[model samples]
Target: MATEKLDVEKSSVELSSSVSDINLYTLHEERAGRLVVDPEEAKIEFGEAIASKLKLSHDGTKVLWPQPTDSPNDPQNWSEGRKTLHLLIITLAAIVPDFDSGIGIASLFQLAAQYNTTTEEINNLTSNWSIFLLGPGGMIAVMLMRRYGRLPVLFWSQIFALGFLIGCTFAPDLNTFAAMRCLTAVFGTAPQVSGLYIVTDLYPFHRQARMVNLWTMGFIVSPFLSPFLFGFLVARENWRWSYGIGSMYGAVVCLLIAFFMEETKYDRGVKDVPEPQSGLRYRIETLVGITGFRMAKYRASWKEAVMSQLNIVWRPHILGILIFEGVLFGFGIGMNVTNAVFLGSPPPLGFDWTPYAIAGGYGTPIVATVMGELIGRYLNDWIMNKSIKRNNGVFEAENRLWACYLAVVLDVAGLVLLGASIQKHLSPAGLIFGWGIAQSGVMICTVAVYAYCNNCFPRYAGEVSALINMARTMGGFAVAYYQVPWAEKNGALQTFGCEAAIVAGLFFLIVPLLQVKGRSLRAKFSL
Candidate 1:
């Protein structure tokens, strides 16, 4: 009787334990299914039931997309002041390439005179070549960043780019100047791609769009701002002074980065990683890349790093976004190039505007870009928050595309207005209004695209950024080859109208398809 009673108790305990195990398993399964609809699409659960299980943002109102580790070195946990300083440094660095490129535009006439060549030839040999290299340079920069470290790659590249800018300032001949320009672009493009990477490192998904807009404002304003300021400079002094000023700007950026920026590249996915040691030796090693090499074994192998970027290039959804962005961005570049020629050319063929007048015109895009930034800063996050609420705290990357609708409308209207104004010889105000409006639209589109792609593949943030940079630069490069000729062959009205139509049609067709089917496509062709 005693033996039987003991056996019965043992059996009862085993059954209860088994039930507990089953209950725990079921709970886990339920959480997994509810939390993520598609992992590749970054479908995250944000509110209520899972709040205690995951890391929440500081305010406790939303779940952090990347759950932070306990390590203090994690950039996500950095103090607000540190993040802001880093952002300012990166933004300034990103502005360097485009700013230098614009200096060439402002000095076009003077360069032609100095080289005994036509303005068209000077543009072709110098600015166009430099723009083409920016894409490829960004790819190389990201590869190095992945294999080495972000801080070292950025710092060294800026130093080399600064050297080349000095070369541009002192070049004695057109060939020498063109060569220097190309080299400057190759090294100068590091920050343009890396800025996005650093932003991803420093901020959560909810804040990335706003931070990206802030960083983007630097480059977006740069192209026009440089020309606006330097156009008059060139008219007073010579083109060399413009490049000299650029070199000074580059120097200032380099100093700020060297002193202030921290290495934001942290492997949060790794388990039991040791806290980074701090001291003079470690700091020196980190800055010069010795630490990166030592820690490289923890990161991807060199070959894997390079091949991963290529893989991202071929993914169907990413490829689609690249194509769409390239086409839309190409038109914006075309406008910038053509506007310079139109406003600066002699009376019969152009506006016959003085350098001062042309410089003032560039202000239109600057103001427009500012307006766009203000709207996009909060626009994407608001759209995303609403979607999350509607879907019961499940965040979908596709919701980010909603902002593009307003962007397309603005873009189309502005392009049409600019074209008609130019074709009909309308007043300067008409030109300015059209230019400002079109720029505002482009600015909004930039923010939406960057935010959406980053959300889709958070792990591959650097790769996504590099590819986007390629699409943007390569598109602009192609347009530069043909923008003026196309406008000359066809009337500006017809030319810009067709450009506007292409943007509208492509955006509507592609964006809607992505909105409805994007989740599935992401799952089917994941990185």
Candidate 2:
């Protein structure tokens, strides 16, 4: 009996020691394989329900992932052309609503005069109503998308956004305009957050970073270009025309989504067993029809989905990413908006800088942002894969933070130059150079932060994304809200100097915290 007790104690110690081998509830597969397998499917398909033992393929060369069965209906097995089309549709969807967020800034003076309000009040259209909506709208969109799937939420949101956008174009008074704008915020912001979820669903970690860079490009570019386009357009025509054009763009995108954006939510039933062909007519019907109505195999309760979104905040790693993103994005938006104010004022050059002139100044940062995204795409992919290889096939979430570290240097240097140029009344080219560099750094930070969150919590993509959106939106609001007052009190040099320090301090503190402790934290609290 004493020997039997000794043997039992030894077995228990061995079981505890082998805990890492049993990856039961990870966001990504932890096994040493090139392909990514769906954990839930591995349980259902394999005997004894062990995820680690049930890799979908043993073939070393073929990169089979998310354990797609041979079914053509599974998005994991979708054709490259089909996936590209969906990506384009999602990218366009993001651009149109995001354009609404910044285009209003170009027409600020006109809106102030037309509404019989101060410039501060009109600024809310850009800073308050537009910026704040992105987070909450994303929250609602993610919950609904998680429950009903992505297509319905996207389709209906676009429909509502189109209606409200047109309503804003025709609104007679400030009250009506603000009301319509708020409504547009609620519905128009789906694509910004949902696209990340789709990327996680369709791509593996090795490929997700580049796809995220691609997904982020349209969103960042649209806001920068909106100011330029609407500044020119409003100068020639009515300010309302910009909103009208946006509504038309939304209408076209909605039509494309209705026809081509297939449901991407992976279902477990299609695990290993190829689905039977449903004939050409059925295939065509699904191809060009509303597919979101079809039920997913593992539908969670509504309460569960909502609870999951709320629970995202409790995750330490996710919350850390949110804070970092919020600060970076918030400061970027503040700088972009404040640049217009500074340029439009009595500058070292002259006070004659018209709306067109201010808008043209935006061209520098816009170009820089686009270039940064393109370059960052390649760098992000290379860094993440290289790190994975070096770590012996174990991909650490911290691998993405290397980009952020480099971005911090660029952002701080650019801020110092921008502040000094403003104080010395330097040439427009000087301001342009600083703004371009700062904006590029911000772009890199955005992509890196987003990729980190997505890689860390791919299963909770919707919740993670919505939270990040909310954090950044809140950050944008806080910065934009206080910017004019702060700059007014301390001057641009002091204000931007403070910004540079704050960003550097936050990056230094948070990046190290996440790098050293993030994995253990994630392990303790599995998503």
Candidate 3:
């Protein structure tokens, strides 16, 4: 029986690995062809005209697509205005879910007092349940969205998330509050995981960089901004308002999604494709969908999707990217958490910050985040485009690794400054400068790595997205769980300084390894 079980497991792995390649080949022929467009065909086919008009694909090459059916309903053929509106809705869907993450940090002291628990216990309420569950929730969302369709899963998930948010606001006890928060976490991750996939669905490779930046901005910004809003409310001893406001925002978003969000799951399988039906039954199916049990447009079974997430552990190149991102991101979160706690205390060096003051301090990094986004939006795009042009319209996954590699210097330098500021308990400006630099560096690194992943595994975009999401949340959970205690014991200089070295080392080691072996590995995984 044990041998049989082993054999079954091995077979499942093989079956799962084949699904992505099959889908890549059958559903999107051009994506499978991978930068092999012929110049003669470019002139004969309409690809050349579309390529020039839309600036699609690299210059000097035809746009490499199977050519959309020219239906107004086809997302590929949607007008720029329609696409922009959808992007706004989807970005909001991704942002609101994460506000719960840092919502209670400023109020932890008060929450602990109310429940007769330690502040550490109250802090655990955010980290242990919500942060830990985010990655798994993202994986679940990806699986469900692939099977059921993006609109129904996202619409329902946000509705449930809002209910849970309200429940969290009214919970009389910590356990009930934590349970509600866990449920919210489970549904909240749909937006981030699904939003990235939606961008891939709607935009081609040449246009993806900008949309992805816009798409991921909310995910990158929310955790940083959450404390700013909640800090003021928590300071007024009106902690419930934090969640109350979130629920209100969620309601608005859910309504918008229900009425406006379109289904993004293209290339449905023959077996799973909807048959022509009419009336109320058809309307309901069109809205909520009943095909979740069947193989989806991308052609992965439920088990295969889950396995793809699991298999991320063994992919060294991906693991390399994950480690670099995980370390930098987690350390930044640690800095934010520690800074809030450190500033709110009484001492010669401390500020004894009011809730509003804390909010103001938290807002400092928002500037840095925006600055980094602007730099990445232009500089990263320039680098990628120049590389594409230089390679004669060919693209490589490793090309974007340069941006990540360059960002590492900025990231590590900022970490050093942040550690110095914390150790000396410097002025607000010093802290702002340090935090801003660190946040900016990390943001650039994130954009670079994410763009690389999306390009490298367009066929398995959902699965790849889930892995990156999981890496991030798991890193946050681990760091948030330990950073405070560790800092309290070792001091900020030691804590952040050590973190910087780890992040830098991981980045340097992985980039060269991936550069050397990434193409071969991707080839092995391809059809």
Could you say which candidate leads in lDDT? 1
* Candidate 2, run of 10 with poorest lDDT: 27-36
Q: Model 1 Cα displacement at 252 (Å)?
A: 0.5
**How do all models score by TM-score?**
0.91, 0.86, 0.86
* Candidate 1 C-alpha lDDT tens digits along 238-266: 78999999999999998988888888988
The numbered model that scores best in TM-score is 1
Q: How close is candidate 3 to the true structure, as a TM-score?
A: 0.86
Candidate 3 lDDT trough over 10 residues, lowest sum: 24-33
Taking the tens digit of each residue's C-alpha lDDT, what string does model 3 give over 211-305? 88887777788776778777877777678888888788889999888777777666633334443344665446655765443425545676776
lDDT comparing candidate 3 with the true structure: 0.72
Candidate 2 local lDDT, 33-129, one digit each (tens): 1223334433444323344444343443223344554456667667788888888889888887667777677777688878777767776654476
Compared to the true structure, candidate 2 yields what TM-score? 0.86
Report the lDDT of model 1 for residue 279.
85
Counting clashing residue pairs in each candidate, in order, gives: 0, 0, 0
| lDDT of each candidate versus the true structure | 0.82, 0.74, 0.72
Q: How many backbone clashes are present in model 2? A: 0
- Candidate closer to the true structure by TM-score (higher is better), 1 or 3: 1
Question: Which portions of model 1 show Cα errors greater than 4 Å?
Answer: 1-51, 272-274
